[model samples]
Target: MRSWKRRGPTYCKDTWGCPRSQRKRVVFNKFGQPIGKIGKKFTNFLGTVARLGAELPIDQFDWRQVPNEKKEDAWEVVQDYYDVDEMHKSWTLSNIGTKWKDWKCYLRKTYFDPGFPCTDDRVIGDQWTGLYAHWQSSLAQKHSITNKANRSKQVMMHTNGTQSFACKRYDLEKGSGKVLSRPELFKLTHTKKNGKIVDKA
Candidate 1:
């Protein structure tokens, strides 16, 4: 397993907030791109109403809004506000607070065990990859980091003053995966056209 994870960017210049991370996510994807780089910053809730009418021109009488048609350009304001806006609003609202993981998990790419010369010529890598961890694994449990500095490192805190890292990893394996749910697995097996797999598990 890798010993350390590269922390998030110190600045927003590298990858803009929420878009890159939530691009694959539904709620933010529907949000229209920020006008003049001022994303989702509406002048007011009524302003949002005005913009939606101006953009979609949905007639109250006809009520002809279609599915997935406006998905990419849907308004976050609309989605978060009206119950009719989101497809899964009920589910989202139901899980307002919950504990997810119970232990920390790490990953490292290597050809041999610890203390071995990594470049040993005999060493080789394999494909068909997945992580190996038991049922209760997390990258952020037990550690108490309520201090401001640790929170700056993306540490999550509870009301009880305990802390945990906010990091996450994909259990690419198919079955018996912890936190397995509706989301697809992050599996990368074969190399692309000319890419090489230096190491894999």
Candidate 2:
């Protein structure tokens, strides 16, 4: 665990208008790449960073819309705990933004879309206190809803359990004594140990 101290909780100067504290202490898990519960925790931390560190609104649609400088500031906030080196700064920034986007989608689909009250501190946490209006407006937009419905209709999903494609690729490459191309990697990952292919097409 690592505790990162920040100036305070802040938000859009004219819109969300959250007060800035003198100092706020945040604890982060000194874990490997954000995945599973660790990823969710990191996502929430990114949300806090958007509201406080970047002085951005909670409803920002595109992560890329956030200024690179502000994103860098957020990256600085997390790099130490995540063990990301300065050399990988670009990837870290992109990862942080992507994680935040994934997190909002999760919150919208699981909690907000289901009519769950956002005020439940135990369930949603204090970090999302001011997200109701934002969720109702920008996040719940028509195109986004359509996209969510389309994604839910996905028929064939990965059967690789919790292991990521990158990890599986690494294992396959190590065992085969040759680097596998995308097609080969896809074929291997989709085929079961019993020789049953996951995708018929």
Candidate whose lDDT is highest: 2
lDDT of each: 0.26, 0.56
Q: Please provide, for model 2 over 111-133, each residue's C-alpha lDDT reduced to its tens digit, 9 standing for 90 to 100.
A: 78678765422233444645556
Off by over 4 Å in 2: 1-57, 67-69, 82-87, 119-130
Candidate 2 deviates by what RMSD?
Answer: 11.6
Q: TM-scores, in order shown?
A: 0.16, 0.59
Name the lDDT value of residue 155 in candidate 2: 69
Model 1: residues with Cα > 4 Å off, grouped in runs: 1-3, 6-87, 99-201
